[model samples]
Target: MPEDLPIGRRERLLAALRSRGSVRVRELAAELGVSLPTVRRDLALLADRGLISREHGGASARTSAPERRTDGPRWVVGMVLPSLHYYFPTVAQGVKAVADAAGAKIVLRGSDYDPVVDREQIGLLVARSEIDGLIVAPELRHPQAPEMLRWLDALPLPVVLVERQPPSDFFIEQLQWVASDHRRGGETAVEHLLAQGHRRVGIFGTDNVTGMQVADGWRQALRRHGIDPDEQLMGRTGLFQRDARISAFGDVVERVRKGTLTALIVQPDPDAIALAQRCLEAGLRIPEDLAIVAYDDEIASMGDPALTAIRPAKAQVGRLAMEVLLHRLRLGHDAAPQQLLVRPQLIPRQSSLG
Candidate 1:
């Protein structure tokens, strides 16, 4: 058998230890075709389990059956998100699919885009003591975000951040997160618009972390293409704040009429649809006078003239977050923290064709 195979490493090590009474680390590394560090780590794990006695440079098998405590209790994961309806149900469904396959149960809770509520929901789950791990999508741009991160970092159980990430300056060694590449999604939208001969572009985003990332991508893309970015063309409003959009409509129309704003990349499909409606009412033809690209793909296709959109791999983020948390639970302290960023795809439609 090939020595490099990992499937039977532990069994082979135990057999060698039993037959020889002791196995040198160098000999074990050579026999297993693994590094000395790998052998040492295995030995340490085995020693902790009472499976072997560690010597200066080797290990010896125990005469009695080893008291193994490597296996962990079955996992029950808690999931908390800011919304149950928009942009999160599909993610939740993906998490549920993985949990079901692993024979694990999920305790789910919803928050109303408030960091305080998010903390409360998480506290409720942690108080139960049955939850082995957690998957959370908290409002990371809120005023209490720093405090929340500190609290989450000190939790007893493992946590996997979903959709949201820590602030750029904050660093935690054991923090794990999985998020969509929203910044790249923004850049892609701008590049597509530039490809379509849009020299002057604008971005309408929400006042949230995802929106900020998209805007950052947009700014970076513009700089890369040597286009002078205009601050007047960039606008950010609160989520679900229709009055803010209404108040900005006049300025937007004036800019469109003056030929300063040729295209726009709007975050969230519903907001894009609303902007498109307003543009149409103002006598601007879609893809003719005003081209629009939406950030979220949800409901973008259903809009009039069908909007071009950046489709983030939301389901994959959820699935990977759950998988990472479960793997950490199984490995205990052996597993390393992981930060995964999945790319987003741009779907071109009639909205940006012109």
Candidate 2:
């Protein structure tokens, strides 16, 4: 923490910077529960103390801000992501590693899955005069996503999206991103189950971008085997409704017992692990009664039988995102934007193979 500064705001600000790498002034204002001017004053003091580096729109950890190179002006980058939890921490770690190596300053902020927050954070970064480029994982679930895309396209700085892939029908040229190809992840699960001679496979997961892509791949893989994909076999639900989730879990267990469903692919670790527990309660033998392949390898092995799962290269995505942004910073904005996808690896455990 910065020495001799006010306890609450300075400590919190430093903590945010360490977790986020960088931050916008408005974001800090909101986080500190202080007014904009107060935040600006605190930032100025911190900068003077050499506790932080004041950049274009916000302040960053002093170490993360690019040093005076004598070769050129300092390069500042703005990054906004959805959340700091779950799948994104590794992503941020990767981004920080690359940025530190390149001697570029990175200002990072979290949008908390709110579309309004996304706009506000990005606007703050863009408002800064020194921000050379941007890396964003926007809230694509918003109703006005297209308008947001247009706005991002109009920004002067080069922009690279981390984990977000806008629909191809939307202007891919306007907003290029690097993301995990979750659709292919789903296909890999189905192919593995098919190879094991499981004919009736089901899918279960929350209704979200990743889940939708995995389902698309699951259906396509089934078609390649000359079988019509069963919509009835697809389960859509979220964790918010506990009774509903459990009821659906019971239904899936019944299906397995009756030999109507021979295997299942479930996305995200929590839901898959929950389903495994439910199956055990229903006296179903894993792989013997039914096999399971889970998407998102996080904690998948914690299940009683351990789960076969798809592991996305999350840190690599972060590393590649910064690399892509660095490439854009060197080349002018006139250069073509790059869109890339990283494939997830399918990990086998006792849940599916045993």
Candidate 3:
């Protein structure tokens, strides 16, 4: 059998397992004349299909039928996110990719940036016992977040959070979550600015949890560079309040003119774009007068001069959230809760070329 063909390799692996009852990964790799990773992947696929049972360093033939329902009852997973547009659609696509591959049905719902709505949507899924697991991206900073998480913890089905973490005060041992390293993204942006010789950098953050983490990263980066963080240089704004964002933009421009800030990091693409426009209107050239870095690379490239941005692995987060929930569903209460953080990449553009 040719090892180059996956079907051939898998068939060979099954034959070897059937004859030997069990086989170590290295032994299988040597016998199949395939790489260790290739053998491991084949073993995983066979295990996923209930054809074998995975062991510590090997796999064994299943003596009885796998616990999965194969006749008619398909695994149904419920997914809830904040929005279907911008930033979340890619995540939803990732989730769908895994669900489709696993032959599981996904019931997706969108919430309106409100924790109450998140609770309502999740409750609806819970009431329907047909749902086997849930993947949710709720507004964890909301006032009702603790109560909502408490309620979720009590649910019988497995739940995995997407891009959200529980409050520091809450003790949730069983809760699992996947999120981007926003704080590290912030620090990376500051490091890039500092590398470009920008002193007295500023941050325009949002009021959300993601924004808070970015700000924390920014602060840490500044301190590491021996620059004292200025409270006046850090401004917080609401996500969708146009008037408030405009005010914050004006404040940033004023600081730039006063020579208090040479570079700035604005979060969530919209605010960054607005600030860039305001800077241009105020007769300040980007990278020359005030270097700019935007978080959430969604629309950063669309800006004039193409703003430098932090690109979070949102799709990976979504896929991992689904995978985690599925693992919990399969392994039940014995599965250890997973806290995964995907790192963001820094995409430099003309906006921060100085």
C-alpha local distance difference test of each model: 0.81, 0.78, 0.80
lDDT tens digits by residue: candidate 3, 1-354: 122235446556755775677899999889888888877877776665445789999998654412455874457888888888878898888888888888888999999688878877876665453567789888877667786776666444577888888866888856788889898999999999999998879888877778899999999999988889874388774532456634666666677788887898988888888878877877999989899899999999999979999999988988898889778877776788898999999999999997
Cα shift from native, residue 276, model 2 (Å) = 1.0
lDDT of 2 by residue, 81-152 (tens): 887887888888898888889887788899888889998888667556467678999888778998777667
Which ranges of candidate 3 are over 4 A from the true structure? 1-67, 71-73, 238-246
RMSD of each: 12.5, 9.6, 14.9
- Candidate 3, TM-score vs. the true structure? 0.76
Q: Give one digit per residue, the lDDT tens place, for model 1 in 1-354.
A: 222224257656766876687999999999999999999888786665444689999998654321223354256788999989988888888898888887777899999788878977887675453566789998877678887886676554578999988877996756689999888998999999999999889988987778889998999999999987764388865322356634677777888899998899988898888888878877989998889999879899998989999998888888898999877877764788888999899999999997
Per-prediction TM-score to the true structure, in the order listed: 0.76, 0.76, 0.76
- lDDT winner among the candidates? 1
Of candidates 3 and 1, the better by lDDT: 1
Q: Which pairs of residues have clashing backbones in candidate 3?
A: none
